[model samples]
Target: MQPFHPIPVSVLTGFLGSGKTTLLNRILKDPELRDTAVIINEFGDVGIDHLLVEQSSDGVIELSDGCLCCTVRGELVDTLADLIDRLQTGRIKSLSRVVIETTGLADPAPVLHAIMAHPVLMQNFRLDGVITAVDAVNGESTLDHHEEAVKQVAVADRIVLTKTDLVDPASREFALFTARLMQLNPGAPQISSHDEDAIAAKLFDCGLYDPSTKTADVARWLRDEAYHHRHDHVHDVNRHDARIQAFTLTHDAPIDPQALEMFIDLLRSSQGEQLLRMKGIVAVADRPEQPLVIHGVQSVFHPQVRLPAWPDDDRRTRLVLITRDLDESYVSRLFHAFTGVPQVDTPDRQALEGNPLAIPGYKS
Candidate 1:
């Protein structure tokens, strides 16, 4: 049976001349990254970007002919569709993942908007993560002057500080300050691009927001083992927009499958947009032997898979949510209502069906 789950497609973004290509070159150079499909977009003509990216035939798509936002938006969709076609037809043996290297001057939002909103493409690809490369030497001023750079940092799942080795030893202090400048979204893991080993580790599977693995050094993800939510101007996003937010939900007992399904359907149908990311290991009613892995993107989901066995004895349902305009009040209330627990003080579903937050769309 074919799975409803689609492979993750991570976006590689950074402002113009911010080492997005250099890091991509490093990734291509890495032997471990062989199972990669790199899609490079060149807004202007001539395709010099394609010349820089050296990969095997059929694996690399040189999209230098048109602007991804306008002229080639259809081609962008068709290009990914074509990759899927080749993969299924055995033209390409196997595809582990896809990476889109946007033009340095491009805004990732429209590109991401294309990926999420397009009906045919959305089913075939899942947004894996956004990796933003920032030039440590010039990042501060660039971030100061460029709103795109700031938005890049604001939405990144991981921020890589590249080209830091050349700076003077005292420059390390500025680097650290720049690193602090990025706590705007404290949930993302920050790493140095100079270390290939560490970058490899952070790029793929890090709890990022909330690592499902208990083995995750929670201390690092929390920035402190005894982490308490601290408000920062980096995270403030004006007196109005709330970008950095965190909330945890705890369940004392196992959840019934029917109840859990209903709960998920409610979330997918209601608050999908605000669900920037969510993951949990839940205890099932009869199967205390194994826990269900609950993972989702916006509204779409991978059939919550069940592990053969719990990673450890620590089997409590703990979920973490990272969002832009959402909070615990909204999520917890809806979940509590679906489950029979009256944790929320609000009225029943019939009353709140008309609410805006109750029907967030999965599409961008």
Candidate 2:
């Protein structure tokens, strides 16, 4: 039997007329993306006429650049499972990666949950990252009116500013728009759609381990520094909606595993819908030598992975959370309670576990 190797899956999402398909069309032409399977919600929605080579009877289209394109027949999980079966049965000669292009108006959390929570898909595939495309012309308006658009930008690993050529780079409006995106997602690097160097190499492989170096790039992966720097720039409180926030929580001491579990359970159970995305590296008291990594979308979390050792000298536990309509104080208080940090009026873990409502701002 051959050893199983999980394929890296990247999700591409954006708002209506955000140029997701345009970016994808360009990405498919890259030679490095060969043997990649592009799963789109609908074939009619995506314009792939220039790249189409031949269509198979099984609904898979062979692209001119050696990539494969398939539309979802039903649930995304079914489409993903079918890809796995095709790989195992020799139907797909080789599959290096999978890129899922979500519908423009869709919230990407459900797609992330499908891969992160499913038992079978989890084993065969690993979530590479989320790449969100924001239209330079109407992005600000889209984010202003649509909550889904805000969530899309908040949870992105790589934000591609599409149709940038149409907007003036030095204009005040464009600057404000870019600044808004930075506030929403400080860690994700923003790349222009027309950037000559924006190829497959730069957009993908945003997981814990760098494919090129084959090493855990913890600092780059966590990017807690970005959140810390966001405080330096003072902006009008009403400039953007306060409901969506990106922040980082850090602790120097190792956390008790049970306490950590309880804190996470309470947060997810009470406010899952508000939690757009959560990723962290924790120093556990039981095994301080090995750090545990956690990634989640809403309430669905990938199984905890214990790294052999701390990737760097910074052994402190750092959690980056992108939340919507969730107060940072609420999360901070919960963390303090679980970690045994005393607050004037906040209840400790023992008391909070008895009644989770004890947290000052927590709402269920």
Candidate 3:
């Protein structure tokens, strides 16, 4: 039997009028994305008239650049499963990658979960990353009024700022908007939609593996330094932005495997919805020589990956979390309790388990 190589699936999401289609159209033109299969909600929604070459009998639209576009006839999982079946049966010539373009107002978490949580899909597809489009002109107001928009940006692996040419980069409004994004998701790199250099290579492959080097690029994948230097800008207490928090949790000591599992379970069970996204590399006490990589979208987590050896000299545990309606202090205390770090007024692991009410910021 041949070894199974999972295809990488990238999600492109944004709020209404955010130019998600525009960015996706530009991305499909790239030669690197030639064999990519784009899954969209509707053909009309994407407006690929210029790129459309012909439509197959099975509802797959072949692009001029050798890309294939298919609409979701049923569930996303069904579409993905069909794609896999086609590939295996030789109905589809080849498939290098998959791009799922979500509806404008849709929460990207469900889309991510469809790929991550499904047992069969998990084996065939690996989450590449999330690319979110933000309209520069209305992004501020959109985020202010729409929690969905905020989440789209919060969980993004890469943010493409659209209509940037209309807004003056030197303006205070633009600066503040960008700063707000940084506060919401410090680790995600922001790119301008108009950036000619923002090609398929730059936008995709944000997982643990760096295709360019064919090695595990933990440092680039985690981007913990961005969180360390996160902007301390204050937001209005009543605004949606205030509810979203992005922060890093670090510990010098190696954590026990059991304790780590307990902590993750408690967090996921107690406040999974609030946990928009989390990715970390940990130093395990059992295997001090090897590091564990963990990535999760809300409650659904990809299988933990154990690296043979530390990627670099920095072996300390680093976890970056992007959460919504969740307190950072609460998470910090929970970690400290599990890691056996002493802190005043924080309940220990036993106490937390014994009395769930003891968890700070937790509502029964």
Q: Write the per-residue lDDT of candidate 2 for residues 96-174, one digit (tens) a residue.
A: 8999999999989989999999999988888889999999999988887887898899999999999999999999999
RMSD of each: 7.0, 2.4, 2.2
Which regions of candidate 3 are displaced past 4 Å?
210-214, 345-357
Error of 3 at 112 (Å): 0.8
lDDT of 1 by residue, 1-364 (tens): 2433465577889887778867876665555555566676543422345434333343354322211211234567877887777678766656666778877666566666656667777677656567888887787667666766766765566788888786663766674546444444565666778874736557754332212232333223323211135344342244222444555566778878787888787676666766655656778787966777665656665555567676655677766565556656767765655545645335445444444234222222
Per-residue lDDT tens digits for candidate 3, residues 111-140, read: 999998999998899888999999999999
Least accurate 10 contiguous residues by lDDT in model 3: 342-351
Ranking by TM-score: 3, 2, 1
* Per-residue lDDT value at 43 in model 2: 87
lDDT of 3: 0.87
lDDT of each: 0.60, 0.86, 0.87
Worst 10 residues of 2 by lDDT: 207-216
